[model samples]
Target: MSGSPALFDAHLHLRDARILPFHARYVKDALDVGVTACIDCATRPEEWAMEVSSSLAATTAYGLHPWYASVSVPNWLERLECVLASDPNAPVGEIGLDGIRRVHDGGTAQRAVLFAQLDLAARLGRPVILHGARVWPLLLRLLEPWADRICAWQLHGINFSHELLALPFFKRANAWFSVGGGLLKPAARLLPELLPHLPLNRLLVETDSPDRFPIGGDPLVLGQHQLLYNQPGNLRCILRAAATLRALPVDELAEQTAQNARDFLAAR
Candidate 1:
């Protein structure tokens, strides 16, 4: 990793309960491989507190993910606002619409929670890390109104759509697209096509670790369960794949995307 450019994992979940016990090893492994920083996207209130209190050397994002929408505490919104208010640099997310899963009200609860979080992001002028699965059109429609108010946002683990890049958010340069292990899948077709179209300055890379384990990815061994989990150290592999897909030098793409992550986190 000596000659490799330092990498930033724009999205991950270091505070996740399953990974929390092995966080130290996870961070060390990533650092040893040149992944110096990351954005910890906490999907629930407890994870948010953990991220804020931990010494992970990464930017922290606080939000309520769609999966936990119905189960979230009544004061979750207030708690989220307090966390964001406490750290101005912190973004609001790992939040958005998920069409595939069945939640409390057949998606109605998910929409309501998403709208609240979006409104909060808009009011605070915070950047957001978004997740939309099988519902890009609906997510885009819901996001359109708040696009002008929120300073910046990233679509994490996004699937490709021709209309995606054409949105006002992209045109205004307020949006970013993050890709991860999904790129390593031999069956992945849309992302490869989406890569060339993404602006270098607006592109980002992430692991979304503990999930979406890249095909052929180097797995982090979890001793207790003997489970293979993705870790930030694997960022280098994702970067290499992205560079090849975009026809850019690995170092060049690495440097640019690292800077992109910085700019996005620092965006007002």
Candidate 2:
């Protein structure tokens, strides 16, 4: 694909591409949003085959996520290694710790599994599309050794606090922030501070289609009440909000971010 400044969604989940209508609608929503490429992140190990087989994008990140943590996760790690070794093109990701929710198995095993993928990515030389919840510290700690090895690392779905960005761990890492409908949350007003520091190339846009939604409560909005029913197409609102915060024209930022994503995948 030629490098066009069209919008690019760096993250998304396509569910199961084998399902016909799901794939059709997912692709339609992405196109409607001008998304040039969407990274479908898979958490379940058994879902990797579906993810790989289903992804229409030339580039994608494949790995087990903490959400599917179990005693068998380690074995899936081996399976992931096999896929990566054979293809060696897919970025290693959708892998990280989520300590905030129902992680009944605890993080010790999760960390071990996460680090193993990190090590594999480093040795093989590829970028990583990450998932970090309250586990930012541990995420950074696990990533420390592999920082230089990363082509580009993205923190999916957050406008992180300065403290996390200020830490020494991120000093060597190239950080990309993904903002979507979730930004509509009152807490997401933080974008004004977050967008300025991140440059165009480092900036990435994503719909996380049929999956991404703002952290805001579903209340009837004032001007556009239709938005109360959030959908993937609403990513346009996210780009508009982000552009306003950065003080740049929406079209310009959209093009730049799209290019940024294409360049990111190229690096791999």
lDDT of 2 by residue, 87-145 (tens): 66677878888866676556776777777777877777777888886666667776777
* Residue pairs in collision within model 1: none
Model 1: worst 10 consecutive residues (lDDT sum): 48-57
* Alpha-carbon TM-score of each model against the true structure: 0.93, 0.82
lDDT of 2: 0.66
Please give the CA lDDT of all the candidate structures.
0.85, 0.66
Instruction: Provide the lDDT at 205 for model 2.
Output: 69
Model 1 lDDT per residue over 1-268, tens place: 7888889999998888877778777787888888888898889988877733444468888899998888849789999999899988889988998976866677888888888998999889899899997787778876777776788988999876655778665655488899888889888888888888888898999999978788877788656555688888888889999999888999999999999999998888
RMSD of each: 1.9, 4.8
Best by lDDT: 1
Off by over 4 Å in 1: 51-56, 222-226
